[model samples]
Target: MKRTRVALALAPFVLLTGCGGLSGGPPSAAPGTNAPPTVPRTATVTVTVSPSTPSASASPGSPGESKLGPPTSTREVTVRRTTDNPPLVLGVRFAKHDGFDRVVIDLSGGRPGYSAHWVPKLVQDGSGDPIDAPGGAYLQVTVTPANAHGETGSPTWVGGPVFHAGLGNVRSVVKTGDFEAVVGVGIVLDHRAAFRILEQRDPQRLVVDVAH
Candidate 1:
């Protein structure tokens, strides 16, 4: 399909520019119910999750998947201008792509500023406690000017706390934090390799692809 999205170009896996932190998620619309039917989900594949992921975060992108460039080690982040509404994290999903594993963070309202980097291990945001994310390497992603819950303290995210991707490289994606306007996503990978992040409009979403 014809896709219209901006490429957050960087040195391979490195970010093109730096950004600030802390923001909430998308709208009040129920998860999956209002999300655009853009990315397709491919389910006929291998599954290695220990307990199995109970969230749509492990599902594949629908049809009309955008053409993101090859994953690179220098890639790091992508930023979206913040809005008064800030967005609500509608859902998180992942799928095994041709040469990498893909992670999609669905959002609403207006896309917000976000950043990510490689961390030695996963940890809770406020408490700083180490998270038991299954994998050999860890990637720390923070979505800011956003929220995973609505104003009434009701959760807007459509998944559980931690979900396993079980792709060739990505093992799982964990929600490490949701304090204030920031929502953290911890991705566990089998090994360290180049990856890139992009912001796609039309049912706004954040896409991360890690090399296999």
Candidate 2:
């Protein structure tokens, strides 16, 4: 009976030692010490692109944007009848500007009626003779009630049928005819382009401007 009581006392001591060993024996660090270092995660990013806007000077019909202007007037333009206001052709001058070439016709008496058009080939006034105007394109300018002569039948405009203009766009100027109260002036261009005509008075001038 004494041996059985001693065995029961030792059994409780053995059970306590086994429970301590199962709890990792002893702690390597204190409780609530330095926590595990937090690892940072990389974030994803997104980007977007948009088209740029045009400036205020960006016009559709600007000279820098287009190489050529609008088409010139195709139909005939006449100021007055051929019999009215006979004017004498005094001189012819040529000028070169930024993007155009100009031809100025000086008159003595008054402004005369004229017809200007693009022609496939420029011919003489009276005789059906072909004028060898030096250019890739030709403009036939005819002024009515006008003459390149004075009252005594002297040649006022002292130039030939073919005159070398050598301007920006105008290659040459040809006097196709001056017959029967009509004066003909041919403009030869380096290339086909748009042109405009203007009439100025006081000294009575006819102006032709061709785009380069």
Top model number, TM-score: 1
Worst 10 residues of 1 by lDDT: 17-26
lDDT of 1 by residue, 1-212 (tens): 99999989663322221211111111244576875544211111122222232212211342234454346453345443345667889889999988878899999875466777778999898999988777888888888788999889988885656797789899999998889899999999999876766556666788777779
lDDT of 2 by residue, 139-192 (tens): 888877789987788988887889898987899988888898989999999987
Backbone clashes for every candidate come to 31, 0
What's the TM for model 1? Answer: 0.67
- For model 1, the superposed segments whose C-alpha errors exceed 4 Å read 1-65, 78-81
Instruction: Give the whole-model CA lDDT for all candidates, comma-separated.
Output: 0.68, 0.64
| Candidate 2 similarity to native, TM-score | 0.62
Task: Give candidate 2 regions above 4 Å deviation.
Answer: 1-76, 82-84
With candidate 2 superimposed using the best TM-score fit, by how many Å does residue 49's alpha carbon deviate from the native? 67
Alpha carbon lDDT at 110, candidate 2: 50
